[model samples]
Target: MTRYHPFLVFLHWLLALMIIGGLIMGGNVLAETPNDDPFKLVALRMHMAMGILILALMVIRLVVRLVTTKPPHADIGNARVNKLGTAAHWLFYVVVIAMCASGLAIANMAGLPAIVFGGSGAPLPSDFSAFPPRMAHGALATVLTLLILGHVGAGLWHQFVTKDGLFGRMWFGKRS
Candidate 1:
């Protein structure tokens, strides 16, 4: 096939927007808002819900990817660079899944489900830093951000510099 399955393409773009938005919401809005702030609860509710949805979509995307026919991997005339590209694609899945898992860990450990979702009326912890998973969540977010930048850079390079049409493979088009 000359292009990715349409469903996979749709998932790729959908997840891209969700992941980027989630990172911004988590890193900026949620991070700056103190746990005591009433708005923090609202932001937490939305952020947690989005994270859960992203996790579900990612799992489905992975399964669809494994089962679908896809174009051959792109080559940019360097074996190491090609392998790095392959590894980075796989790493996206690993880092994103781990990021979601760490977020879930923090929520469960901090009793966030009861507070944020269940409306149990329990107060949020004075600080999330006390939770070990919070640290991992932040670190994974940084990694995921870097990976995204690199992926975009590589795609641009392939499209503009190499002129290999690699970017089009992941975009909407006829599969053949």
Candidate 2:
């Protein structure tokens, strides 16, 4: 129910783009394509790499969140809404970190080099197997999807029904 801090807003959008890209790549066309195909491999690899970046960014966001005091939910509709919103935010954080941790472990085991956004060479240990990467990739993808649905659903409820400032905290105002 509290307004998100400025840094949280920045991190949310930053992570949002990464998450959206992965979601789009998860489309049926992309999922059904052969892994051996160069284009398919590249696309999959790109998605995996983006997942790695998200892992890193989420870590940073968690650290920031831990140290900062969140803004008040004084203007929020009521106690029930505020509690749900708060729980949803923490769920988001927990799921994201879980996904990231799994992804990084997979990357380490899969021998796919770590990928940095707009940068080169994150060189993961070469001995890591592809299995861990594949497993983590699947697990994290599932978690991210569920959390996303919950997030969107809550946003819609706030925007359409309560006329609360919940969405605006992340989209426009600080937790208003």
Query: Any runs in candidate 2 off by more than 4 Å, and if so which?
Result: 27-30, 73-84, 114-133, 172-176
Residue 67, candidate 2: Cα error in Å is 2.6
Q: What is candidate 1's lDDT per residue for 1-176, written digit by digit as tens?
A: 89999999999999999999999999999999999999999999999999999999999999999999999888778899889989999999999999999999999999999999999998999989999999999999999999999999988888899898888888997788
Model 2: lowest-lDDT 10 consecutive positions: 121-130
Clashing pairs in 2: 3-175, 109-128, 109-129, 110-129
Task: Output the lDDT of residue 66, model 1.
Answer: 98
Tell me model 2's lDDT, rounded to 2 decimals. 0.67
Root-mean-square deviation per candidate: 0.6, 5.2
Model 2, residue 117: distance off in Å is: 13
Error of 2 at 4 (Å): 2.2
TM-score of 2: 0.70
